[model samples]
Target: MATTILETCRVPAPPGAAANLSLPLTFFDIQWLHFHPIRHLLFYDYPCSKPYFLETVAPKLKESLSLTLRHYLPLAGNLIFPLNSEKKPEIQYVAGDSAVSLTIAESASDFDHLTGNHARDADQFYEFVPEIDPVTDESEYQRVPVVALKVTLFTGRGICVGFANLHCLGDASSVVGFIKAWASISKLGGDEEEFLTKHAESLPILDRSVINDPLGIDTIFWKVIRDVPLKSSSFPLPTNRVRATYILRQADIEKLKDLVLAKKPGLLQVSSFVVTASYVWTCFVKSEEQVDDDDVLQVFIFAADIRARIDPPVPASYFGNCLAYGLAKIEHKQLVGGEGFVIAAEAIADQIKNRLNNKDQVLKGAENWLSETKEMTAIRAFGVSGSPKFDLCSADFGWGRARKLETVSIDGEKHSMSLCKSRDSEGGLEVGISLPKARMDAFAAIFEEGLRF
Candidate 1:
C-alpha cells in the first residue's frame, strides 16, 4: 500500500472559457453546503510502465481535462462564502486565480486485489485518492475548493483515476456528466472540434435559474445552516473498514420484484432500483447483530434526480444539483423479520412515489431537513450513494471501459452503499458496501442466502 508522489500541479480551463464566473447555489445545492465531499476512483487496466504512462497517457489526460474544464469552469473554481454570514455562498471562477489541482502518483499496491469482488481493506485506497483541502479562512471570505483529482499508475498493471468534489457543487448526475465529457475529450486526444461533434449534447447547461425554489426553501435552508455548526468536508475514514462488491443479475432483480409482488400485488413503484436498494437495506439491518430492539426505528435515506420531476421540468443537461431527498422509516422488527425484503421494498417505493411525483411533497419537509439530518446521526440510518444510471463503466477515456469504479466516499460511518451498472452482465447491478470485518461477513452471508430462493 505504498504510494510515491510524482507531481502536483494545477490544470486550468482553456482561455476560451468565460472568466470571472459566479454561480449561485440553489435550494437543492444548499442541502449539501457543509456535507462531506464525494470521491470516486475509476480503475483501468493498462499494462504499461511508469515511464510510458508519464510520457504519453498523463499528458493527454491533463490536456483533455483542461479542454473539458472550458465547459465546466466551476470545477476549477472555489466556493466563496462571505464571512458576514448573511450573503449566501457561490461558486466563483476567476481566469487567472482558479484551476483544478491534479496529483500524479505511483502505487505499488495489488491492482487485482484492490478492484476484485472480494473484501479488501478500505484504508488501502486512501493512498491513491487525492484529498480536498479544508476550507481556508480568507479576509472577508472563506474559500473552499470545489474539485481535486489524482492519477495513479500501478506500474505494469493498471491506472486509477480519482476525483474528489464538493457535494454542494453538484450531484451524481452533474458529476457523472463531467466525467463522461472528460473521457470523450481524452479519447479524442483533446480534439475540441471532433469532441464537440460527437458530444454536443453532453455539454452541461450552467444556467441555475431553471431550478425554481417556489417554497423559499433556499432561505429556510440557509437559516438552518446558520443555526447549526457546519460539517467538515473531510474524509475521516476509520480503521478496520473492509469493502466488498456484490452483483445482482437481472434475474435476481426480477426474482426480488416478484417476491415483493407476491405479497403486495398493487404496489406502484417497484422498479429495479427499489428492489435492489431494499434488499441491501434489509441485509444491512439484519447484519447489525447489536441492534436487537425490534421496536427501534430505522430510517432509509437516499437522493433522487429531479430533472424531470420538477414543475416546468428542468433540462436533463442542467448542471449542478437538481435532487430531492427520499426518506423512509420503519421499525427494526419489520425490516429484519420474515418478509423483511418485501417490507423494506414497499416502504422505500412508497416514499419515492410520493416524494418525486407530487410537487408539493417534493419539498414537504424542507424546513426539517437540517434537524432530521441531525436526528439521523443519532439513529440507525441506512443510506444509498451513487446510482446505476450514471454508468461509470461507460467512461472509456480511449483506454477501454473502466475495470472498476468505486464510490470511495461511502466508506465512512454513514452506513451507506454504492450502486453501479455491472461490468460482467448487461441489465445487472453492482453493489459496493463497506463495514467492519464482522458486519461485512454477516452481510455477505445474509446477502448470499437470501438470493438462493
Candidate 2:
C-alpha cells in the first residue's frame, strides 16, 4: 500500500489551555518513561464521496478533536526531563500556538483486505500510524509531543484514523476513554462548551499525587531507566515476518478450558485468559523445534492492572500507568511436554493471582527483577499485550463503530500477541499473532490441532 500526504497542520487545544503548565509524573507513569509510544488504527467503511468527507466529516473530526483536547490538554503537551530539577520528569502543557500534529493523507491499498479478518503484510499498516518523535538529548530539558494523529482516506471506500500516544501519559483504559469522548462529541455536533458540560463525568483526573508510592518505586524506576540506553525504533524484522488474526469462538474457549481442567481436576482457576494465553504460548513454543533443549528456559511475561488492587483503590478512570508485571519461567522441556498447555495455564493463572493478592510484593519483585536482568531482552520471551476487557470494537466516531481495530505497534516485537473482545459480542476472543512466514503454517496447524484435542 502506498500513502500520499495531502496536508499536515497543528490542531491546538482550546483557548486558555495554551499557558505554561506542568503535571508531575507518578511512579506508575515513570515506569513506562522509556517504553515506546502506543500505536492504534481504527478502520471505517464510509463508501461516501471524498468531497462529503472533506466538507463535513473532516471538519467535525478536527473540531471535535480540538474540543476533546481541552479535557485532555496533557496530550497536546510535551514530556520533559529537567536536568537542574530534583523532581522526576513531568509533562508540560504550553498554551498559545502549540498543537497536536494532524496529518491528512490518502492510500492506494485494498481497503477490504486491510480491514479484513485474515492475515496480511504487517508492513502495510505502518503507513497509517503517525510518528511521535522522541527526545534524543537528555542533558537539558527537552520538549517532545505526547501525541500525534493521522487520518488516511481510502478514496471511495472509507477512512482510517491512526492515533499515537506516549506510554507514560496513560494506559489502555485512558486511551479508550479519550477516544470514546472524542467520538461522543463528534456525534453530538453542537456547542463544544455545552457538550463538555453535559458530559462532564467523562473528563480524566490529572492529579499524579493521588498515586501514593510509599516504597519510593518512582525513584528506583527512574534510576533503572536512566542507566539503560534508549531503544531504537528502526530495528529490522526478519524478511519473512507475517501477521495474522486468529479467532477463538466461545465454544473453542470453553473446550480449551475443559481440556485443562480435565488434566488436573484439582485445578481451581481455568479462566478464559489462562486457557487462551496458554494455548497460544504452547503453539508458539512447539513451532520452534529448538525449544526441545532441556537447558533452555521459556519465560512468559504480562502486565496486570493495579488500579483496584492498590490501597485506597484508584478510580477505574484514573489517568496514567497503573500496572505490575507478571513473570512465569519454566524449562523448555516442561513447556513442550505432553501436558504443556495445562501446565502453562496453571503458571499464568498463579502469577496473575499472586500479583492481585500480593500487590506490594509483586511490585517489589518486579523492581528487583528489572534491576537484575538489565541485559535480557524480549527476543526469547512470550507474552500478551492487549486485553479482552478493553472492548476496542465498540469505539464509534459518529459514522459507526470500527470495522477493525489493530495494535500495529506489536509488529516490531517478536512473540507478542494482541487480544480483544470478539466483534460478535458473543463472549468469544480475537487473537492477533505475528510470526515468521515459515513458522506461520506450523503455528496454525498446531493451534487448530490443539483446540480439537
Computed on alpha carbons, the lDDT of every model, listed in order, comes to 0.88, 0.78
With a 3 Å backbone cut-off (N, CA, C), the pairs that clash in candidate 1 are none
Best by TM-score: 1
TM-score of 2: 0.92
The ten-residue window of minimal lDDT in model 2 covers 230-239
Which portions of model 1 show Cα errors greater than 4 Å? 227-232
TM-score of every model? 0.97, 0.92
Candidate 1, residues 1-453, lDDT tens digits: the string is 489999999999988788679999887888788777898999999899888989999999999999999999999999887665788878999999999999999999889999999999888888878888777877777787899999999999999999999899999899999999999899988889998998788789999889877788888887767544444465675557898999999999999999999999999899999999999999999898777577999999988898888777899989999877778899988888897889889989998888877776876776677777878878989898999888977898898999998889888656999999999878899999999999999999999999995
Instruction: Write down the lDDT that model 1 would get.
Output: 0.88
